[model samples]
Target: MDTLTLKIIFMIGLISSSAIRLPHQQQNKQNTVTDDRKTPLETGLLLLVFFGMLALPLLYVFSPWLNFANYKLPLWANGLGVVSFAIALWLFWRSHQDLGENWSPTLQVRDGHTLITNGIYQSIRHPMYTSIFLWCIAQALLLPNWIAGFAGIIAFSIMYVIRIGNEEQMMMDQFGEEYQTYMQQTKRLIPYIF
Candidate 1:
């Protein structure tokens, strides 16, 4: 198949996969209780990050009719994209496994939960966010076309910057000394090497 055809097929697969909600860490606990403090502005911006970062690139791919004159990438660029995406997917799966029932779109403490210290959580306090960052980076590397990659990176970065502080403060308040200890032990997005 030609390049455009491959892009179209990839776009369809990407959108289909992302449409469904996936599971997270801590299988035995209930993870759905939500705090009610998110403002409409926060929710709206987050939705943009989630969907726009994910969907827009596929839209550009499948519907070249809507393409905004993207830069052409060399074959090597596509290879870089694949590798980045592979690493990102690995991190995401690890994060989900670590989170189990503790995972939710919005921040909420799970019922009868302990601070997770195993797996990816051992290296970074927020593997989920790290996954997100790497995912965006992968998109940027893969697309190399600038618009899709940069869009995903900037959108996700903004969302995390806005969301993380609030979430961290809330966790600290809830877990107190335990959370502080964890904070001291783990970096936010990178491992001890960082």
Candidate 2:
């Protein structure tokens, strides 16, 4: 098929994979703690970033107003986008699987939460963040519009820079020295290369 068609297909698959995980994540939210560091500002920024990165791009994909299809990169870029998306999905799923009930959509210590250090968590303190970074890269590659293509990376970087310290502080508070030790062993987003 055409390049746009292939790009659309990859985007749809990425969205579908993300959508499928939502219900499962909601079910697990029952284990989350009432007290959380998910401040209103943080939540607002997250929503803004989500809209900019995902929603706006999806809209741009189907609409003419923001269409920059004429600026599309070589077909290999789209292929790379698909590969990045596949890796993101795998990392997202694996991180959730490894975290189990301890996983929270925000910064919170779950009831009976244990510091997870095995599986994908063994090397990356935030595999979910890594997965998201992958998504940003894929989005940049797949979307032709300048705003839609790069918004994810910009927004995600803002959120990550602002939130990671707080997240680690919360973990350290909850797990004490254990979390500190885990932090020493793991990088934030990359394995052996952060």
Candidate 3:
């Protein structure tokens, strides 16, 4: 209904997204990486993603520094954003739950990594990434400010454009034909659609 309400909704979404990932991030530190595929480009882009997704948004949400760029959205759009955020949070949690020990923050494969083709992974090759994309969409819809609202999509788009192919290649290298078959069967971001 109001600007503050939308910002609060965005904050809730941000916190929810973080809460979904927190446990997995913690667990990942204890796991050894058997295969490290991180490139300098990826490492660097990830930092950009960090700032774009988290830092910039946090600054806008907490401080009035970026308020000049604020815009307005229709009530329907704001509702859609809330729904989008809800779905994004669910997918985020489910992706992590399905991946379990296979999850890693970087491009490295964990020591006991296993190809996940069940649960959320059954219909999507990269549900976690899909969740992030959806979350970005929610960010765009929820946050009225230009920089904080849109940075997630822009930075994540760059990361996804550069990283998805490599990530798929890594999967193919590890699982070979099995991953190939899985790829053919499932869409990258959507189910029954691409």
| Two-way TM-score contest, 1 vs 3, winner | 3
* Lowest lDDT block of 10, candidate 3: 1-10
The candidate that wins on TM-score is: 3
How close to the true structure is residue 163 of candidate 3, measured as C-alpha lDDT? 93
TM-score of each: 0.82, 0.91, 0.97
Clashes of each: 8, 0, 0
lDDT of 1 by residue, 1-194 (tens): 24564365335435433532243323433444544446686787788886657677766665564455566667776666666666666777777767666666665665655678888898799887876777676666555445665788889888888888888887887789999998999999889854
Show where candidate 1 strays beyond 4 Å.
5-21, 24-34
lDDT of each: 0.67, 0.81, 0.91
Candidate 2: regions farther than 4 A off: 1-3, 32-34, 68-70
- lDDT for model 1, please: 0.67
Ranking by lDDT: 3, 2, 1
* lDDT tens readout by residue for model 3, 1-194: 58789889988888888888899999999999888999899899899899989999889988999999999999999899999999999999999999998998878888878999999999998998999998999898888889999999999999999998999999889889999999999999999998
Q: Pick the candidate with the highest lDDT.
A: 3
